[model samples]
Target: MRYKNLIFDADHTLINYTADERDALKRIFEEIGLKFSDKMLDRCCYLSEFTWTETGLYDVKNERIQREYHNLYKTHLDLLFTRIFTEFPCSFSPIRAGELLLKYLKDGTNSISHAEETIKKLKTEKGYNIYIATNGLIDIQVGRLKRFAPYLDGLFISEELKEIKPNPLFFKKILERLNCTVKECLMIGDSLLSDIAGADGVGMDSCWFNPKSKENQSGTKPRYEIKDLTDLLQIL
Candidate 1:
C-alpha cells in the first residue's frame, strides 16, 4: 500500500449530512411549534450555503484569514434563525432556535452508503489507520460518528484544533499528533476547497470523493478521485 494512514472528511464523505440536516431541520421546526415543509427546508439549505460562502468559510486563502473568518462565523449560529425564518412569523429567538437545531443535529447518525463496511475492511484487511478530519462542530460530529468509533483510530475536529481545513496548521496538527509524515497519509473527502486544498497545501496526497460527479471548477486538484467509498480499496 502507498499510504498507511487514511484521513476522511465526515460530512458527505462518510456520512449522509444532507439527510441528517433535513431530518434535524424538520424536527427542530416541529419542536418549535412551526409547520415544516420541503420548500422551507430548501430555502434554509440555500441560505445556509450562501451564508457560509459569503463569509469566506470556503475561500480563505491563508491561515490568518481562515482563523479570523472562523472566529467571526461562530456567531452565525446565533443568527441562523433570523436568516431562515424571516417570513415564517416565528416568535422563537434566534438563540433558542440555534440551540434546538444543534440539539437535533447532534442526534443525527445517518451514514453514507457502504461507509461502515468500507471503513471496517480498510482497517481490518488493509491494516490502515483510519481517522476522521472534519470542520464540523465537535459535539454534533462526535454523536453522528458513534457508529464508526470501532473503526476509527481517532478524530480530528476543527473546533478542538482551533483551526479549520484549507489551513496548513490544521493538517500539520494532525500529522504531529499522529507522528506520521505527510507522504504516508492520504486525505479522502468531498470538498475541493477544504479537504483537497488543505491536504494539497500541506504536501499530502489526496483523493477527491466526488460521488455526484460535480464539476471541479477550483484550481486545487487531488492526486486521485473516486466516485465511491469502495473504490478506495483498489487505490490504496
Candidate 2:
C-alpha cells in the first residue's frame, strides 16, 4: 500500500454531522418548549457555523488566535446556545439547553454513506491503520465514534491535543503518536481548510472528500479529490 496510515476527518467525511446536528437541534428546541421549524434549524445551523469560525476555530495560521481559541474551547459548548439564541427569547436556561443538545448529539452515531464499509475494508482488507482526526468536542466525538471502535486504530481530537487543524503542530503531534512519517499517511476529509491544508502544511498527502461538488475557492490544494468514500479504495 502507498499509505500505511489513513487519517480520516470525523465530521462530514465519516460521521454525518449535519444529520446529527439537525436531529440534536430539533430535540433541543422541543425540549426547551420552542416550536421546531426547518427555518429555525437553518438559522441555528448558520449561526453555529458563523460563531465557530468567528471564534477562531479555523484560524490556522495565527498563533495568537490559536492560543485564544484553546482558552475559549473549554466553555464553547456552555455558551453555544446563548450565542445562537441571543435574538430569540427563551424561558429555559441556555446553558441547560446546550447540555441537552450535547446529550442528544452524543447519542447520534450516524455515519456517512459507505463510511463504515470503507473503513472496514481499509483496515481489514487493505491492511491500513485507520484513524480519525477531528476538531470536535471530545465528549461528543468520542461517544459518536464508539461504533467505529473495531476498525479505528486511534483517534486524535484537537480538544484533547490542545491544537487545532491546519496547524503544523497538530499534524506533527499526530505523526509522533503514530510513529509514522508524513509520506506514510494520507488525510482524507471534506474540509479543504482543516484537513487538506493541515496535511499539506505538514508535507503529507491528502484527499479532499468533496461529496457536494463544491467549488474550491480556497487556494490550498489536495493531492487528490473524490466525491465518494469508496473512491479512496482506488486511490490507495
The C-alpha RMSD in Å for every predicted model, in order, reads 1.8, 2.0
- lDDT accuracy of residue 74 in candidate 1: 56
* Residue 189 in model 2: lDDT: 93
Query: Against the unseen true structure, what C-alpha lDDT does each candidate score?
Result: 0.86, 0.85
Candidate 2 structure quality by residue, lDDT tens digits, 73-184: 5356556678667756676777787778778989887799999999999899999999999986788889999989999999999888888887899999999998989999
TM-scores of all predicted structures: 0.92, 0.90
Worst 10 residues of 1 by lDDT: 69-78
Model 1, position 57, has a per-residue lDDT of 66
TM-score result, candidate 2: 0.90
